[model samples]
Target: MNFIQKEFRHILRDTRTLIIMFGIPIVQILLFGYVISTEVKNAGIAILDLSKDQATIKITEKLTASGYFKIIKNLNSFDEIEEAFKQGNVKEVVIFEINFDKNLENFNSANVQLIADATDANTANIIVFYTSSIIQNYVNEQNKTIKMPFEIKIDERMLYNEELKSSFMFVPGIMAIILMLISAMMTSISIAREKELGTMEVLLVSPLKPVQIILGKVTPYFILSLINAVSILAVGYFVFDVPVTGSLILLMAETMLFILLALSLGIFISTVAKTQQFAMMLSMFALMLPTMLLSGFVFPIENMPVWLQVICQVMPPKWFIIIIRNIMLKGTGLLYIWKETLILFIFTAFFILLSVKKFKIRLE
Candidate 1:
């Protein structure tokens, strides 16, 4: 009883540890419960309504009202479909033929083309399947109202990933997760090791400025992390057949930026943590959970609630994953992913500045 009381007092005294042990579990459970879902909801879609008839309008209304999809645009021509996809506005495009209603009325059948962006193969599959079911439901309802047998057949096409390869989805996500955890965790642990051994005090007494001290600590990890990133990319390309469809130089540059962000973030964590164990746990639970769960790596972000989606936007890995997927799978250039890139740059700058400030306060 005495030993248990002593341990309980120790645990209670460390407020940060207590919060990490108790609070994080609650937060993580709630986040995962709400965010981890297989069902598709509010997936963005586009309509190439060539028919411009009553049936097309009604079908469009039904699709939008069903809650499974939202129209990003009413495409003017078939040519706009690619542009719509490149803009990342729509996951699925529904193309109605020139005389869809006329064919249904006269020949008792019509064809509807369902083109989906298959970058995330699972989500694409679910979106198309849900869409087919809704259309088929509409066809069944029409059969009941009409004396003749009316049918609407779906012609499905998957863009970006023709085979709907799971690797296409997993590769980019894994890269984000790996880079974030490795770079941040290693840098934080390295700094916290110094802090624990009292060498941090020696460094603080030296003539080095806060920014220089930070740079000196993180430079080694930055180089090592970049090497780790290249090795992962090589494995992804050779073993998983993940192609770098966009400019390799641009990809490497973006990767370097992300590594810097991770290093700076790690430095920030080390400033807060008083010991190596604290830093390790902080890095793992804080960075790893959010990156894996909320970054849209393992789950679909559109399926999550609006509030949860807002939270995901703040996570650095979410934007990185988007940039990486756009570059690698879609073969898109900066024109398409400029917004995501800018967001990442802002995050990097914020962390670097904050870390420098925190290191100055702590050391001084």
Candidate 2:
């Protein structure tokens, strides 16, 4: 208890520790929740309306009013369509062929072409989808009045997140990042700081077992990291509408397991890092980047190259993200996530055993 209290005082007295413990999580959640999004809004487009008729005009109005598109240019020619894309002023171009209204009236069909910039395949797919949906809805409505011979309808069922809200994706990733930062980076730096100041040797020589000393150093951080994790989950749930469809107890239990894994990794890092700066750098470069990038936080793992996917298999955050997504989004129980849970348990055990072996060698 005395050792734990002393560790708490040392952490509280440090301004940087306080900021890292509290400030970063809140800022990151807010930033990613509101600012980062995959949904397209007000995507610029050009229209080439050769028909100059009411049908083309009505379709154009519907597309603009849908709010997913902005008609930046009423293009005069195909040349202008190419120029608009080249200038990066528009992502899509809608072309109506000559006698469009006549064709629709006489033959119940008109020629319309949609050309999209496929440079960003995801965004382009979204833009095309939104544009086509709006156009199709208008066509359906028109058919209801005109009594068309046949109609094709699409029934879209978006499971988990019907709206495709990016926040749902980001909240889980942010929680993993915050927990990793607080548990692993802070723990590593704290232990390295003690070693740098020569206090670690004194503590090692005192009336404490090797495991006891390591536990005393990490216990305070474990508590603080749990608090931080709960805070992030609270903000994500209330502010961002992120849901925990699974049992809250299970979510928290898995979170604790992940925190333990991170703490164990921190201990291993502390054993190797002789200076606080080196520990920080090592944690940031090794743990932070993998947590953010390779863990399917920002990039989908399926999209990565085969070799990168193999590398991501060893990343703890990757499995943690899969576990949380299954629990939160899919609402699956332990049976569903047992494999990932076992993997995390193995990682935690491996790190702890390695750290213990290293600590014993250092003491000898």
Candidate 3:
């Protein structure tokens, strides 16, 4: 009983410890609730209109108007189509046969070739779907226009990001959350370890101020987390050809912010836990679970329960994943993500202030 009291008193005396105790779980909960998603949107596409006939033009217009694809370029020839794929701007290529209209009029079936980049197969499948749907709709419209009894058929031209790219689709999100767990949450707990061990007192008694001590502990982890983020990105890029479309600097900056936010949250947990085991349990249940479940990092938030949906609003990683996807996949700028960035900043600032306030109070 006496030893327990002493331990409790020590924990109470350290404000940083208390902050860590609460911060990690809250972050986890929010992460699980809102950010991760599996749905596809706004895929980049290219067209090689070899036919340039009324049928081909009509189909192209319908595909673009479907809102699922954005035409980034128009290829002059089949040779240029390959170059576009290599450059990575085009995810799928639509090639119209030279005599598409004539063949359709005569044979009642025209062949179109869809060449998908295939590197990220999941997105490719969705692209195929969107493109095929547009073409099918065009054909149906033509049948109605000419009053043909559907004698003519539409051949599918689909490639890459095929039906089995689920693994690749989830790679970015999995990497983001796992690295977050290993880097941000783990670093915070490790730093707070000194508090649980009574070694924090020795450091406090030294010439080092509290801020310096914490910074020194967190610095190494910051470097390591950034490295992990980069490594994961490299694997996703070179190994998977999921090239980043946005500014590299912006991606790095957002990653740093998310890491710092998660680290700060871990620091808050350390302040509250009296032992390493408790700290770890809290981090796993609170940080890891929600991050994996809610942040759309693994599962879709739209599919979660209503209460879980409301709870996800508080998670920081959810926003981070959103920012990452926006920049990496959509190639969007800060203008598109400014609101999310502000939310992350607010979370970071709030936790930092709360932890600092608790820390100062503990000194008294």
RMSD of each: 14.1, 6.6, 14.4
For candidate 1, give the lDDT of residue 150.
85
Query: Considering summed lDDT, which 10 consecutive residues are worst modelled in model 1?
Result: 29-38
Choose the strongest candidate by lDDT: 2
- Screening candidate 2 with a backbone cut-off below 3 angstroms (N, C-alpha, C), the clashing residue pairs are none
TM-score of 1: 0.58
Q: What lDDT is obtained when candidate 2 is compared to the true structure? A: 0.82
In candidate 3, what are the lDDT values of residues 68-155, reduced to their tens digit? 7788899898778778988886888888888888888877878887777766555666576667777877777778877543333434
- Lowest lDDT 10-residue stretch of candidate 3: 30-39
**lDDT (0 to 1) per candidate:** 0.79, 0.82, 0.69
In candidate 3, clashing pairs total: 25
Q: What is the lDDT of candidate 1?
A: 0.79
**Candidate achieving higher lDDT, 1 or 2:** 2
